[model samples]
Target: MKQLLLIIMLFLISVAAYAQKVYSVDYQNQADVKVFVVKYENQADLKVYKVKYENQAGDNNGKWFFTDYSNQAKKKIYFVDYENQADLKIYFVEYENQAGWSKMSKKQLMY
Candidate 1:
């Protein structure tokens, strides 16, 4: 029974760890994180990949699953017009395997 309980707790922890559901808000004030899309990957703080399914979302490692509703998302983000105005700068990657944090110091912004 103790092993079963441990297994259940571990499963729940893993699920919570990977929940990177995000929503794009229209206004900067409505966002949890202000994002700027960098043209070059080298310029980005994080390399993001848009995952089609919510289950495929990464554990704050840049695999983002966009939710249809803001309430359903873990984080609400706004895209800034300029890099200087942003709290986090990201580059969209072409492949899932390429998605991850380039600068670890900026990682807490997503959380």
Candidate 2:
């Protein structure tokens, strides 16, 4: 029972650490990740869905909750004007189910 409880606790902690609670920073230098919004879905590395609540945020799976304050966020991101300048290129999806990393190679950037 102690081992089971420890495993469960570790799982929860890992999930919380990976939560996609993001804040948009005013400057590129202030950001943890530099992102670009792609015009087309095919051009994107990740498809994002903005959640209304922070609890609805995914584990680096593109379901993002935009935090009002930078301190409240798990990741601070800057929206880059050009795709070439971005570390990650994303497309906003209409549905939550559509949110996920398209290019698996770039998945580590979220972590």
Candidate 3:
């Protein structure tokens, strides 16, 4: 009976592990800066990552991602999805006067 319970627990754990969704930022093709809107499978938190990319070194660049429940200005990535191919891929750029983070539309994306 104990062995059967252990088997059931292991099965449940594996199922949970299989449920995660992940996306890759096309850094090579992104704007100078890219905002990646990552939605978690848990639905408990919504995140917008601000990424600053450069064409200089191969590995390091000035990428940044920030979010606050502060106000509605940061709602650009509120509805992004990884599974849907139509959804925006993660990347960053500079906004108009805002000067810090910018959301790139599907057309503006480098890739």
lDDT of each: 0.91, 0.92, 0.31
- Give me the runs in candidate 1 sitting further than 4 Å from their true place: 1-18
The per-candidate count of clashes, in order, stands at: 0, 0, 10
**In model 1, how large is the Cα lDDT of residue 96?**
94
Q: Per-residue CA lDDT of candidate 1, range 30-100, in tens?
A: 99999999999999999999999988888898999999999888899999999899999999999999999
Q: What is candidate 1's TM-score against the reference?
A: 0.86
1-111 in candidate 2: lDDT tens per residue? 999999999998876764798999999999999999999999999999999987788888999999999988888999999989999999999999999999999988877
Residue 32, candidate 2: C-alpha displacement in angstroms:
0.7
- Supply the global lDDT for candidate 2: 0.92
Better of 2 and 3 by TM-score: 2
Q: List TM-scores for all candidates, in order.
A: 0.86, 0.88, 0.23
Evaluated at residue 3, the lDDT of candidate 1 is: 100
Model 3, span 13-91: residue lDDT tens? 6533322112233342432323334343232111222333211111112122322322211112322234343344333
- Kindly provide the TM-score of model 3 when superposed on the true structure, using C-alpha atoms: 0.23
- Judging by TM-score against the true structure, name the best candidate: 2
Candidate scoring better on TM-score of 1 and 3: 1
Error of 3 at 38 (Å): 8.5
